[model samples]
Target chain A: MEDTVEQPKAHGPHGYSARKDDHVKRLRRIEGQIRGLQRMVEQDEYCIDILTQVSASTKALQSFALSLLEEHLRHCVADAVEHGGPEADDKVAEATAAIARLLRS
Target chain B: MEDTVEQPKAHGPHGYSARKDDHVKRLRRIEGQIRGLQRMVEQDEYCIDILTQVSASTKALQSFALSLLEEHLRHCVADAVEHGGPEADDKVAEATAAIARLLRS
Candidate 1:
């Protein structure tokens, strides 16, 4: 906790920083889809219809994830690999774990 | 559009009508999570942390879909099967299609 308490700024920006606005826009749209699902439920819409929306929202979230993952590989992982050290391995491993989680979900 | 415009009341209500409040509540929570993700991106939170949250949100969406699907099977599909007609086949096929879409998404 002591050493990790540095600060977000200490790392400059994250891999996603370059596409921050795009990410935020995509998230806001996903939020709208969630709200739409709530409305469909409240209105007693057809079950299959609601499920379809769920699928769309899930896809959108995954798409956003893919974008973030690409940026991560391009910037963070690439940078780490360039440095040629133990941290490079950790970065790639961390990214792999995140991909595994996404796939399982 | 003609047949579909018959009104939602024509079908009574969907299978999820039984747990309307629960579904709405879950959706609202998911919506909150999406907003949190947006904030994370805006704040330049770590890429890994954002990806982790995306996985959580995606998982939650899928969970909601599963719940809706279960109710659809227990109620709508069951009713159609009990009636013993072509509609039963249609219901089963529709559900299968929905599941496939979810998988691909």
Candidate 2:
């Protein structure tokens, strides 16, 4: 039984916990907005109107991603750089890859 | 004026373009499903039914995240490990932080 007990998960360098609730709340609201868009489509709403809603929802997601990225840079990347070693290089490369993906989208 | 010319964005090691279309398509479907859930609520649909859709939608998002993670590991992480340098370390750290956020959610 003792062996079966799971160790706690490690938190990331970034203070993700600090903004976790806020991020979740924003996502939930975005979820609601998505639902609204579906309703508009079903009820024969204007095409432009539906498109507008879609654009808005996409923007919300992008904004959320940006904020998360900022947090990662400020905390995780900063920590790794301060440490100054192979691990520091790893963190920067990892972040660069992520940023590339985001921009490509 | 020459400086104003925007350089093309760099690609991530993972070849994100290889599956970018697939990811976008899945997201669009998820968006549609979200709309459906909204309609259910608006029409006073049963609580359980709406909850179920929400669950499904959430699962879809999770799956998408998993796929993206897989791609990152296969391409970006693998490349970094092979490179065996400071950049490699940075990439791994970046990815570790991302996984942490995903798991926390």
Candidate 3:
């Protein structure tokens, strides 16, 4: 087994562990951008203005996706492998295909 | 600074740490499924078969996404917040919007 670093146990009612404060923070900003986009569309903002923001949004999303992908590759997958079997292989495959689809989109 | 556990600084040319071996295994299975889908399409498999696979693929993708999302909420995002500032918030927001978009898809 690989070296294990015990993370702080975060208490929460959401089934999964408590999310990072930074994650929540990032989410809030994204929400603002989304709202801004909506306003732009409603106000008939310039195509360039809307598109520029859209592009920004897309890139931001891609970055976020990349970060999450990295973590999955490092943690959950690692844990699954350490534990063993065909199920792990199926899971990794499922994840990769999903990633390919995301990249395509 | 929070509790830091030094993970095996896996040696690799890949800028990021070496991915969990399990991730590769999952990816391989997903790849096989993709190939199977392609073959099925080439042979003009039944719509239901394709659709069923498509649905399965989508669910699989979503599951993968969820797993990644959980990790992000735990690690990178946690680190960012601990470090401090607006950049962290921005990143978290960016990630959140992307997730919302993904869930919608």
Candidate 4:
């Protein structure tokens, strides 16, 4: 099957756009896990057990963010750097801020 | 309104059991945030914007875990310590392990 990204009008397709389906699937699974945590809470599962699940959910989220960041650096940031302009610095700084947010969160 | 925890079978009501509704509400909101991320990906939203949202969701999950942990310390661990037995040490050890999991995750 063709892996060409279906471009959106607002801007060029993102690095992740090619693997959109895979990303969506990963997110949906994380969503399900969150819902399962809700069910466990409703059932009054042990507190430690619920905490374990919460940790797992958080890890899943961080993993997703890391994957997206990788693609952003490989495509968007790299493209900007290749052009050798002030925008390249801006892109690098912007990416750094995003990483800070992830770390703090 | 009566805040008396509705005890569950198999064991006494857990520390967070009294705030079960609150915990469930938080989980549901986090779940919604995850779905929102999926939509952002589907629509090809900027990766930075999506990353921001992911950080927010992760923060929310951590907040929920911290709240639950506070309650566990106030009730479950406190109760175990009051009894002054080997079980109290076990509870503290178990809680520490759970916290470690959260950190590593």
Candidate 5:
């Protein structure tokens, strides 16, 4: 089991450092907000107030997803298009499917 | 604008360190996996093969969420239950709503 524990891997060269860092930072903030929400509930805050926080947290997550999607389009999709082949088509289709999933969410 | 950049906050004592660390680690792995999936598509891999990787990436995300949900129930919900009040009920309700959102996703 100890041997199975994987080391943290670095992002590839093509990885967008600025956007990825922003996403991780935002997520950590969201994680803290979630913990705060739990505390509010455990302290017996008003139901409406708790629900409001839930909405905020959900919106934060959605915002993160949108930012990530935009970054993907600008970087990954653009690269595929420049290459210009079946790969480009595949990249577009994959991105479309991802957007569809986000919409459903 | 630079002054507005918030410093990274530390998790509270109530935060489950082991589980949170595991979750973050898993998510980083998923991030890498997502990048890989994009590359696969951009390289013009077979449609079916790209789809398979997409399925795997999605499953990894689901696994991360499930782990997070379990940790929340064990720590946050259990804490609320121990307190025993309207807060406990709110906590449970919040958790239920979260689970519903996850199911929809």
Candidate 6:
């Protein structure tokens, strides 16, 4: 809803921007997890150790994905309907499919 | 690979940053598409017309998801395995499941 040019933005319907500082911070944490894995490899750490890091990274990524998806539905879909048309129906379907995929994961 | 604080960054292992200007530009385009959908509705466009835009938006979002998934595999998974632990297996399974979900959508 608020746009600042400097923020990291995820584009969604209606020129909507997902520019959240916390999102970026979470991504940075995920990035750190990845780096830690890299170091573990170089040190020849145990397999289980690496696996744990991987698990953490995956969950982190999923969490971020869910957040973005939530915003998409709330803002994009809602706006589309207010402006109503076939677009609304299409957005609903598209969002539903996306959610289905997330749940499947 | 490059580190620019101002650039849009997707952090993965080792503080690796997906700071691609092109990616951000593409996101901006997607945002614009959404806004266009908004206008179409305000004008009371046909259902089919709106549906067409929705389809386009879905495709665009899917494409973006695909790219991110690809990156996750190349960087995070690879690093996880090299570290070799239970973590490695977990990461592989996680990545596989994520891919399956994407395909389902």
Question: What does candidate 1's lDDT look like per residue over B1-105, in tens digits?
Answer: 113445464244777775788888999999999999999988888888999999999999999999999999988999899998899999999999999999999
Model 5: residue A95 alpha-carbon error in angstroms = 18
Candidate 2 on A1-105: residue-level lDDT in tens? 112236232323133434655655666677777667545534434323343454566556556566666766676667768889999898777777666554444
* Fraction of the native A-B contacts that model 3 recovers: 0.00
How do the candidates score on chain B by TM-score?
A: 0.88, 0.81, 0.74, 0.88, 0.81, 0.77
Model 4 C-alpha RMSD vs. true structure (Å) is: 3.6
- Report lDDT (CA) for all predictions: 0.88, 0.57, 0.59, 0.88, 0.57, 0.55
lDDT of 5 at A44: 42
Query: DockQ numbers for every candidate?
Result: 0.56, 0.03, 0.04, 0.69, 0.04, 0.04
The residue-by-residue lDDT of candidate 3 on A1-105, one tens digit each, is 222355434212221223446556766787888899999999999999999999888777776555555445434544444455765555455655666567457
Error of 6 at B13 (Å): 5.6
lDDT against true structure, model 1? 0.88
Question: Quick one: best DockQ, which candidate?
Answer: 4
Q: lDDT of model 2 at residue A23? A: 58
How do all the candidates rank in terms of TM-score, highest first?
Answer: 4, 1, 2, 5, 6, 3
Q: Which lDDT tens digits does candidate 3 get at residues B1-105?
A: 112355334323221224446455666767777888899999999989998887777766666556555445444554444454775555455655665477447
Query: Cα RMSD for candidate 1?
Result: 6.0
Model 6, clash count?
17
The 10 consecutive residues of candidate 3 chain A with the worst lDDT sum are: A8-17
Please list all clashing residue pairs in model 2, or write none if there are none: A89-B90, A90-B89, A90-B90, A90-B91, A91-B89, A91-B90, A92-B90, A94-B90, A94-B91
Q: Report model 1's TM-score to 2 decimal places.
A: 0.89
What TM-score is obtained by chain A of candidate 6?
0.76
Candidate 3 lDDT at A70 equals 46
Off by over 4 Å in 5: A1-105, B1-15
DockQ for model 4? 0.69
Instruction: Give the alpha carbon lDDT tens digit for every residue of B1-105 in model 6.
Output: 444556443333232234344444555665566566555544434333444554565565456556555666666777777889999899888767766555544
